[model samples]
Target: MPESLKKEIGQFNVFYIDYDNHDKGYCQSYRRRGFYKISLLEGETKLFYADKTMTFKRYALLFSNPNIPYSWELTGNNHTSFFCVFTEEFIRQFGMIKTYAVFKPGSYPLFELSEEQFRAFKDIFLAMQREIASDFLYKYDVLRTKVLDLIHAALRLQPVGKLPNKEANSALRITSLFTELLERQFPIESTLQQMELRRPAEFANHLSIHVNHLNHSLKEVTGRTTSQLIADRIIREARSLLQHTEWNIAEVAWCLGFEEASNFITFFKGREKLSPKSYRNSKIE
Candidate 1:
């Protein structure tokens, strides 16, 4: 965190910047703040995302939210994209987060375009660049609406099965809230940050429900127990931290909520068949 007054940043912000390369797209300066990011990108792009690596070849429409951890690199072509980022605060003022599938997990992140699709998306992005450059009042309002139009437009091209219907069912709704709450605990980007919810009961208490009820909803919807889901996600993040970061075993353990480093070592070895240090070393080798 920046100590100076000049360094404290506002929750609602936007940017249009150029990428330094395909491998790091304007990534050197920006700290992730769980913002909603939209980019109309060209070239072969790679995104290291959520324990997976995915690549887009030449022209893709991309959307991402802060709950996901990702890094973008270009493998070919100049990085030319119109990028915009806004926080949950911006969305909350005009729309509910739950209403937009664009920010949620399992949300569609890329739309591979047909020639017709490419032309249509290109118009919208060009219009965005033009309208945002104007000094007119309420331009951001127009811009916000345009962003929604783009999201809904890309959403239409997705297979109907992949899109979530209105989630009015009470059990499904509860499960959604649980999963969102669960996902919010992750992407563990900083050494100073720590997991806030480590146990099912703790999550249940925070959700104003009984532990048994939370477990039931999750199992009913996902066919997995609450503890299983939590453990799986923690292990996924553990592997990512081990492979990608220079944080030592003790620091990694502390970030994941282990009071004793030995406990983390045991938990990791049980699941991964190796100590954290061994796994990390293996990654480098």
Candidate 2:
């Protein structure tokens, strides 16, 4: 949000945060920002992702996807970091950004870094900063290449594993289809666009399968029932809307398929142990 520290080129922007000027601490609750972010942290910090917490004692790389809600704060220690924020449209030509594992919905996007590794990434961010302020006509192209470099470097840092051989499995295929259908209804772009499939029966009907068949496939693959999975994902979206959106309880309820605000209150309290308003207030500064 600092105007001077940010350098923008098209939909991409990079920022510099130095130790002396770093704010004491701040939290950004999850919301759909429709942008991707990559940050290089150079001190102690704590990251809060959906249902997970990770601490970094020194250097670390964090990748954020617009679909996932995450936040980080300095742990009362001196910190210096550089970050870049860009929309999917900014780099769509390079590749399908979501195909990368780091930006996947249930991925561990944080990576601890050595001094050498940190400096390598820091150099890319610095180059981005300089390029954005340059007068060159094709500087945006250069920045796009630099962004890919950062992504590839982070991928290398990840632990490599032997991939399993592809095999035909009907249950797995059904589960995959179910997951796609479930994800397609997410981010709840507007109040007018209410969720149409909040139940396994509805999802099964859309997939042209029986509700029992869909439930069995999901349970076999994910070790959880279909209804449970739907509820979990709904709760996550509800939390995000509560924390980040100005829509009142009634609007949020309707957006998530609850016909009444009271029904939403009861549903939210059952899972989160607090009312939606209280959850929103807890995130307020």
Candidate 3:
């Protein structure tokens, strides 16, 4: 993360993509960015999300949260679009953004937009850009509404279903807390910034609950065990460090809570089918 960006976690920025001014560096790698992003893409593109590949030949709206690791490639000539990136603090007053399905963990955040819908969304983004640049007072208030507009617009596209029951909603809330806690420890920027919560019991203890209770809550909502979720997130961070940083395997292991490089290698290989060094080399090639 850039130093300037690190200081502006509460700020937001909007942009209109001029192909001439577009930079591929922004979409170059699958890593957890320090902020959230919502983009309206108007060209052919391939999105490589963790364990999933989605190719969009036309228009698509992509919602990226700080927790997920992702990257994209432009496959077509036309690269015009609109996008806005903001940190959680930028919209913290609205509510927990992760509670929404599009930003929720394990949910696919991409939405296909029709031409008409695209036009409408374009208007929203343009409005946001305009408002953000204006000298008017309470412009941020207006921007917040526009952000919610974009989210609600995508929600409308999703198939309607029966509302989640009370019990399920309770489970969902616990899942959201677990997801937030897990995400808070990420984007690990340095070797000295070792992870403090690497075990399920530690997380549960921190939350003042039993380990089995935490596992039950996660399983109820995500259908995955607590250990599985923790391991998956560790793998994600390990991959990011391997590809995006110059850290050696041992450094990566230490940052991720593995005391020894061999143990880290074994853990990574068991999940990824490739050693950390091999994965990094593959990305380089």
lDDT of 1 by residue, 1-285 (tens): 233212213433344445554345424213464467777776677765433456767777777765445567677556667666766645555766556766555554666666677677778777767776776555566766777778788778662123234432444556667777876877799999899898999989988989998887666545568898788778988998999799988899999999899999999999999999999999899
Q: What is the lDDT for 253 in model 1?
A: 94
Rank the models by lDDT, top first. Answer: 2, 3, 1
For model 2 the TM-score comes to 0.57
List TM-scores for all candidates, in order.
0.52, 0.57, 0.57
lDDT by residue for model 2 over 1-285, one digit each (tens)? Answer: 333223343478899878667456865843435578898888888887644577878899998875445677787667887888887767878986767877764456898998999889999998999998887767877988999999999999962221132321455557667777887788787889799899889999988999998887676555578988889889989998988789899999999999999999999999999999999999895
Candidate 1 lDDT trough over 10 residues, lowest sum: 1-10
For 1-285, candidate 3 gives per-residue lDDT tens digits of 555334443577788876646665247432334467888988778886543577767788988876556678886576777888876656778976776788875566788777888899999999998898786667777887898999988988852132235665555556777888887897799889999999999898888888888888787655578998899889988988999899989999999999999999999999999989999999999
Candidate 1 residue 215 Cα shift, in angstroms, is 14
The window of 10 residues in a row where model 3 has the poorest summed lDDT is 159-168
> Worst 10-residue stretch by lDDT in candidate 2?
159-168
**Who is ahead in TM-score, 1 or 3?**
3
lDDT of candidate 2 vs native? 0.78
Off by over 4 Å in 2: 1-10, 29-32, 159-285
